[model samples]
Target: MMCDLETGICGPAGEGNSEMELIDLTAPTKKIDLYYVTDPICSHCWALEPTLRKFLEEYGQYINLHTLMGGLLEKWDGFADVSNGISGPGDVAGHWREVGDHTRMPIDGSFWFEDPVTSSYIPSRVYKVVQQKDASLAPVFLRKAREAVFPFNKNISNDQLLIDIVNSIGLNGEEIVKESHLPAAQESLQEDFIMAGRLGVRGFPTIIFLNEEQKGVKVVGARPYDNYVQALKQILPEENIQPKAINTLQHVLQKEGLLFSREIEELYNLAQQDVAAFVEKELAADSYIVEEVLGEKYIQLNQ
Candidate 1:
């Protein structure tokens, strides 16, 4: 996939198609298979986190979500994006800042300049290790890795850093790292790379929604929330497939273990300041854990 500097997608562009038809999901219970193609260090994927989470939260019951690593950066050794004129890690710092501003996702791009990740392959492979062990943990590790790199400037590509992220999620980090070196984990990541190619995916943030018959509608790029919803509707056209809604801020907090101001802003349609006010109220209730980091808030149930 050719990298587009303007979009931060290392792939060809795909328009959201809403074909009219219903195919039975292969899984007996779910309606669609959502294949999420993302990378650990993809700034655009990081920008997409809130929208992706809200989509899953509302429709997760009807969908089986699968995480596929896109291997965004094999190595920065000879990397050069002519369109964006980015030849190395430092070149991406400003672009990340712009993405953060545009998406309302807090991103500290200083890591690109300070603790640059030479390759995203390491974390991507480690993701395969976790996925091989527990499908649930794979996405959890992916989220944590992105949280570490995007806002905290942690080098996700580093060995120790990847292990630490794994450890934070209750895994034996050293064992996981050792397991990652095994043939199976690396092979798993390679399979994803091959699948991405076969699926005509050339970039980060590419999601293909497939019905039971395997007919798919691909939504590419960091699109608005409506685009994704429309794509899902097109695939299933069933009015009953309604999005699940939360009645209150506390309800939402109860659903998600951790909440970013940006995530809550998207989830409940609240302004950033209002998120602050509501979170403040929750904090005063004495049942929430709120941490202020780099001028932002991370809220979760105290338990």
Candidate 2:
């Protein structure tokens, strides 16, 4: 089966639903090991950013999150995702627009029309190289890559844009770009693909939770906030997991640096109608910079 646009499940044509793996954790460091399998260009993965951020903020103390790239599109060879009603790359434009509208995230989806990406492998490999260089920088680089493609209409498969993103994170963009072309980067991405296959993963935004006993549970798709919280609770029922309130924009932006109005709305517990007013207040009162993109407001802390 092809990818389902409604569920935001992007995978190969014939992969099954993800089943939790019982891999042996050799003296697991944390109470839970979270393998976050996602794609840089996956629409649902982009949608999961807000909820995923809250999950990490609230329960990050008890979990060790490992990001694994799920190979989504590898040179779309006349490929059509029948399940999602996408005939080609041009079809993705409208679908992603709808996704942005529903999720309240700032996604432009115009890249598919302006300059469509041929393969996700290039950017994914760049991320793998970044992951190899510095695990901390990889997340930021990936986020920028997503922001580039989804909202900014950047073709991340290109080397120059990828280099710019690396430089933004205070890393040596030239050195990293040079290494991303090597075989090792591809190998690292391949390893992730093998693991995803072993786990029977069928889409992007698949989170696998494993406890000390090596027992695992899978949470698939861009689900509601409670679905993620409950998944963590299921694995660590014995331990007390009090979800920290997502009450501060400064705290969240300190790490992420950039956030959209809807993202702040979700984290701040504001109603959809109040999103504009809340973001406007934050900008006008506290002196934050808001960048408008595709009819959405993105607040960024002054650097």
Candidate 3:
């Protein structure tokens, strides 16, 4: 699904017609770069986490992955759409519930029902601040923010709530807060918007593979793991491609900390019917992981 940064709504990617022309590249580079265009609160983006995690685990050494924020929602005002039957936060909760049911992703819709977020800009800006401080830690912070909203039902728009999430992730909250409001942080966020527009990105969870010559392939919306692999291979045909096999449950848990049956199925290309049973059987006999059914079944490494 595509999320409009200007309207702050989710719809099919490239739903509306675009008048912009594609930019031509000069030459191909020696290395490939993966530009991941996403929004913090985008459900489709959240659903693609497993595939993304697996992609990074396998091809991290060969590719440079850049996470760019797609401004999903600017503000709640001036948004009134009765066509799709989504008018307010309550409607959004229902939509989220449907997404969770379809994707098997754990999403607590109470945040939309109880305390709706006014804007996604706050978290998007905060991400730029964290990226500026330490690029590697930015992904961890983003994961925590997603967990807070999706599973924990926490409103991350609140300044204090955002700070709490930063602190919980072992980052200096005070430093993050101080840097988040700086001119440079705002500029960094603006740059993401400009880059998205330049790339003609109309969706969240969009993956663009660009080689040194600037030749690129754009994959929009959340697709299968093989789709991503194909995109990478298309960009880097000469590179030796070695697909990693999922050997044990511990390996998955060590990489993701938390595991969903759907995630395992997608990562390993397992059949849907066997996924739940396999996860349950593994958790039943294993001492390192614990399974919890909070609306949906989730497994995490036992500490």
Best by TM-score: 2
> What's the distance in Å from true for residue 246, model 2?
3.5
Note the residue pairs that clash in candidate 1.
11-202, 24-212, 25-212
Q: Per-residue CA lDDT of candidate 2, range 1-303, in tens?
A: 477666567777436544444654433245788999999999999999988887887778778888999988888787778999987788998989899888878678777876888889989998998888888989999999999999888899888888899999989888888888899988989999998887778888899999988898899999999998898889988776776666567667778989887787678778767876776655545557878987888888887
Best by lDDT: 2
lDDT of 2: 0.84
Candidate 1 lDDT over residue span 16-42, tens digit each: 222344765542244888889989988
Q: What ranges in model 3 sit over 4 Å off?
A: 1-30, 80-87, 245-252, 271-289
Ten-residue region with minimum lDDT total, candidate 2: 20-29
Off by over 4 Å in 2: 1-30, 245-247, 273-286
TM per candidate: 0.84, 0.85, 0.79
The CA lDDT of each predicted structure is 0.81, 0.84, 0.77
- Best to worst by TM-score, what's the order? 2, 1, 3
Q: What's the CA RMSD for each of the models?
A: 14.5, 15.3, 15.8
Pairs that clash in candidate 3: 5-71, 27-213, 28-212, 28-213, 29-212, 29-213
